[model samples]
Target chain A: MVASFGPVALAVAIATVFGLLPLFLSGIIVPKKPDSVKNATYECGVETIGPTYIQFRTPYYLYALLFVIFDVEAVFLFPWAVAYRQLGLFALAEVAIFIGLLLVGYAYAWRKKAFEWT
Target chain B: MSFLSCPFPALVCNPFGLARDGIYGLLAAIVPEPLPTVALTVLGIAMLIAIIALTVMSQVWVERRAVAFLQERLGPNRVGPAGVLQSVADVLKLLLKEDLIPFKADRATFVVAPLVVLVPSLSVWSLIPWGPGLAIADVNVGILLVLAIGSFTTLGILAAGWASANKYSLLGGMRVAAQLISYEVPLVVSALVPVLWAGTASLQGIIESQATVWNVFVLPVGPIAFLVFLIAGIAEVNRSPFDLPEAESEIVAGFHTEYSGMRFALFFLAEYSNSLAIGALAAVLFLGGWQGPILPPYVWLFFKAYAVFLILVWIRGTLPRLRYDQLMHFGWKVALPISLVTLGATAVLVSAVQGTAA
Candidate 1:
């Protein structure tokens, strides 16, 4: 078992070294030529505008929260998919219960104007 | 019986074979018994590496051609006949291109992001069963494993965006994270219908059960689950309509804006490979993966996966991307409710049928 892990460990080490070595090499070899124009935010070469970092709307975060809930729900599907055959009718019934709950959540989100395009 | 005609007859005299045996003997000297398992482990790793690399490369070419055809144009025909060598040419270009990292970027995380994208993408394949008796592991929680590993890709995308220190990249990453997370709910709920029917999370078990009748035909809710899986998959891979993160017109390549050359290619490779991975998962979950007459199992697996990929490419070419709000709305309000209801109904019907069967 120890021997079995040797190659995998080696592969990971090699991959990590290759992935990171280039960054250090480039930093050392490449000339540092910083200028105001070079550091400017990219927006098709217009003059300096207002502050680039502004607080974004809270709606985006709400969307993200909703996303987390749904994503967790999606994660449950994989196991369900794998075990679909054996679960048979009883299993299906259980899923129906799960889905019913999810639907309620969905309906709640919908009525709250979550889908409205602003 | 026919020693002269038999291939590899020289195996009787092969020194390398002897040397290999000698090495095994030496290892045996250190630890007794189970010599073959060590050799098998090495072979398995090699096979996995080769399979993942080959799949990623071939799928890239397939996607380009499929997208081109959908758009009514020839894609990469100049590189090789029917663009067969397009991916190969791309590999060379990526190899030759100078890898550039922005000075302002988070050095460690930016570099780590691509690895994050790739490793999880490849790892998910460990659970997929291409054919009967063909898989890396036949775990009972194979479905859960896939879901768990697949979600890591979103983290990788976010890491890329945040590490880049570019506003567009940050916006793109945030959008992708949100989209993937939201759509994941319906996708999972819908997927549960199949699990409820199958009763085991082993992929091989799913295929074996479906051998007689595919779930698509058996359950009305199965198709609904399939649709949810497809849409969620598209979002997961950031392909077309849901590809808000890499919206070239607006975000200037999104999370990967500051990346160049090989580093950028890593993201590209991950994108194409993830597309294939998700497509394959969809096939396995809903389309009866490698479940067909006559052809070999792996061939059927590829055919189904490629078919899904073609559909993705078609959508990419045919549809316009949804705005951020519209994207969120559709997932939360539309797909989520429909899928949830579908799951509930499937469960009720399945139980009633079981009552009858019992």
Candidate 2:
């Protein structure tokens, strides 16, 4: 298993160097022109008001919860799908029940407005 | 041409395989055990980097000119012939520009965000099968690894947003976190249809299975899987129509709002690389990757990837961006279910028709 991934490890290693080369070069080749005003956070031309890192309330929180549940469920689906030809209809029944349960949760979330963009 | 005389008639002739065997044999005969391996490894790395640099340069130029053609304008015609060297100039200017960091930003995370964003795109390229015997990784769980690595972009985007310490950037980051994760379900599920039909998650395995017939032509679920995969893929790359995070008119450059100079260009580079990854995957999973007659297999992969990317550009030119609510609602309500049903349908239909028969 580890031997098969040798080429993949090499590929990632090569890509990391290529990807980070420019940022490294930019630091050496380009001079920094930073100043207090120039480095301040942007908000159009107006001076920024209020703290930029204040506690934030987001409507996406419920969706985030939904994502965690569904994403985990997908982990099982992928393997089952890959091995479907080998797995008999009994395995299909198991996947169907699992997917059916998830769909119930999906509909429940819908009814509960977990996906609402409030 | 020399590799065409390969002995196995049942298996298609693989030029890459022949070249690899020839070089390895020559090097091993001339040198000791470890040295030949090291030399070949270094050569492969050099070739990989060269290919990436060339791909990025050409992809950016093609996209700009294509989008320009769609908008009825000449793009970068002032630069080298037909503005082909425009990206080279742009890269030089970006390198020359002063790098800036916001005063209140989280210094470590701010510096690391672009690198994180870039890794997923780079990592996926390793596993994608450009042709038979052509993938760098060629591992068993190749497609699974792709979905796993490709999901890391959200972390980078959110980090950029939070580290920037700007309201709009945070909002943009939040949108990306939601958007990428949501679209991912459909993308993964649609990809599952091909995996289920082909009975393998190795990208090369899927491509070889399509040697006789491509996935897009399979009855019932093939076209549906392709359709969902295309939609979610466009969203996954943050292209137009699903570009809520980069909605410039509303939030101003999205998560990278405060980035400038090469740092910003790195983000841009990663985004384009991700788009290429999507095109490559779509080509492999749907368009009979490297399966056309007559041409070298790798060339077919290139042409197919280019055609898919051009379709993306066309859609970018034609479609209007979706509203934020509509985007999220549609992902959960529409795309997700369609992909799931297709997956289930493919399992039942394929099993009944072909699984037990085998």
Candidate 3:
């Protein structure tokens, strides 16, 4: 398992360094001049009104929670798929159970209107 | 037919292997034992950077020209024959411009966000099979890795929007995050259809399975999965129609609105590169990567990839930007349901066929 990650780890390190090169170069190559007005938050040529940070709706969190359910379901399905041919009918029934449980939760979420946007 | 007479086979089968092996040999000569491996890895990354830049540049030009054609106008015909060099000129201009970050912007996050967006786009190419021997690293769970890595772009966009300290940017960033994550579920589920059908998650194996007939021909479910994958892939990459996050008419420039100079260009680069990467994955999963009669595998792979991308370009020119509510509704309500059903159907079908045959 460790050896399997060798190439991936190496690739990531190299990619990170290469990816950052241009960002580093930009600081050196380009001019950096900042004034108070120029650096201020952009509000379409007008002074900012009130606080900039707005509170997002609670519905987004609900969407995220619903997403986690499906995401985990997908994760469990991956390994079952790879060894699919070798697995007996018993294993298939287990997966069916797994999917059924997730769908139950999905139905619950739908009834609660977790999917509905306010 | 004598093997000696077939001059094109070597070149066609593995065009990149010679250069890659040469680099390895050079590393062997210069670097000591353990260091050579790392050096070769670094060289592979450097080559990836070059490839990303070239591909992104061409994609930008192609997109611009195609969109222009759709609009009844001539796109960039001045600089180099047919204005192919226009992207180069654009990049140079972007590089020379002053890098600016608003004072209220989250200083560190704003500065680092572009790289955060870019690295994933570059990294996903590692698992992609260019030809027979051209894959840099053939990880067993290639599709999973691609999905996991591809999601980081959302993090980057969130960073850009939140850091910008601008309302529009913040809204754009949140929209992007929501849209991307929601679409990701369907994308992964749709991708699983091919994985289940091929019985291996490795992209190369999937391609090999498609040798006789591409997966798009896999009756009833194949075309459905392909369509779902394409739509979700488009959203995951934050392209047109699905690009509610950066709707220029609605949210100005969206998440990257506050960004300027190379920082902005990096986001642009990441966008097009990710577009190509998504297109590449779609071609591999459905259209059959590097698999065709005649022409080199790499050539075929690129041809198919560009074909997928051009269709995206056609889509951008054709469709109106989706409303944010519509985007969310479609992802959660429409795409998720279809893909889940398809995955279930595929699993049942595969098991039945193989079990009966056994």
Candidate 4:
């Protein structure tokens, strides 16, 4: 396990450098003369709106809530899969039950149109 | 025959591996333990990152020209022999542009968001099995680790959107968060099927298990799982027809709307890198990583990965962008269910087959 993570540590360190190097270089090399007109929040061609922070009736939250639940359930399948060959039929049935139980919630979500973008 | 001629059987595919061993051999001969190993690992990862950059640049050039060909237009033929140096030129210009942070944007978060987006995407490559025994880390829980790391991009994107303090960016961020999370379910579920099929979480083991046949050829379940993974992957990277997040027509560039210069370039880098990563992961899982005849294993991996990516480029060129509502419905209602069922069925069938064989 320790051996496996060696590359991960190295890669993270390298990628961090890769990610930051350009920004660091650009900060020094790039021209920066910030003016209010230039730096104003992009609004295409429109002038200053009523309030920049507009309240949105995002229908995505329902989907996000469902995602939180189902995504966790999906995570649970990983260990079960890795150890599957030895699990035999009994564990298969148990997993079927497990997935079946989750599908109930999925079906309920579907019935309630939790997925729909209303 | 190949092994007889070359002592290192996988030398063609495993350059980093060879380099690591060679580094350790020379350094160990000269110095001592642990330090040489550390130095070798650092060098390997640095090389890996450099190669990823080269691949991403090539992918950028290939995509523009390929998509243009799809539309019967001559694309980027000017710069250095069929526009091969176009990405290089674009990078140079982006680096010199005025770095601007929007007046209302959260200064620190805005600056950090691109790095947050970029690091995880690059890190995913370390665990990818390019050829047999070619991965930097053959972690036991490779698939799970990959999914975990890949999910962090959503966080970075949300930060970019929220930090920008712009209405369109905020809306785009929220929409993207939902899209990514919803698509992730199918992606994870389908990814795990190959693990269950191979009976190991090690990506190299999974690839070796597919030497005789690829996972996509498995009857009943393989094609469904591959289809689900592909669609979710396209959504995962915000590619069309599911690219509603950054739909230029609707959102004016989505979460990165307020970003400019190197910051904006970082986001583009992350996006393209993630797309290429998705292509690679798909090649590894479904099409069989580094498993082919004649060509070297690493070369096969690259061909398969680029082939998958070019298919996506074709998709981007051919298909119209999806409406946000349609994308959400497709992810949650359509893809999620299909993948879930397919995974369950795959588990059952694979176990049954193994049981009988035993």
What is the descending TM-score order? 4, 3, 2, 1
Question: Against the unseen true structure, what C-alpha lDDT does each candidate score?
Answer: 0.69, 0.82, 0.83, 0.84
Chain A only TM-scores, each candidate in turn? 0.70, 0.85, 0.87, 0.87
* TM-score: model 1 vs. ground truth: 0.80
Give each candidate's fraction of reference contacts reproduced.
0.27, 0.69, 0.57, 0.82
For candidate 3, state the interface root-mean-square deviation in angstroms to 1 decimal: 2.1
Kindly indicate the candidate among 2 and 3 with the higher DockQ. 2
lDDT of 3 by residue, A70-89 (tens): 88888778887777767756
Residue-level lDDT tens digits of model 3 in B66-140 = 999998999999989999999999988988888888988889999889989988888888889887656777888
- The candidate maximizing DockQ is 4
In candidate 4 chain A, what residue range of length 10 has the lowest lDDT sum? A43-52
- Cα deviation at B67, candidate 3, in Å, is 0.6
How much is the lDDT of residue A83 in candidate 3?
72
C-alpha positional error of residue A76 in candidate 1 after TM-score superposition, expressed in Å: 6.9
Model 3 whole-model lDDT (C-alpha atoms): 0.83
Model 3 lDDT at residue A50: 78
Best by TM-score: 4
Candidate 2 per-residue C-alpha lDDT over A1-118 given as tens digits, one digit per residue, 9 for 90 to 100: 6546776677667777776788788889887777788888883446668887776655677778888888888888878877777777888889989988888988998998877776
- Model 1, range B83-195, lDDT digits (tens) per residue? 78888888666666555556566789987898788666665665677665456556676676677777888898999988877788888888778778777676667667667
Q: What TM-score does model 2 achieve against the real structure?
A: 0.93
- TM-scores of all predicted structures: 0.80, 0.93, 0.94, 0.95
User: In every candidate, how many clashes are there?
Assistant: 22, 0, 0, 0
Candidate 1 interface RMSD (Å): 5.1
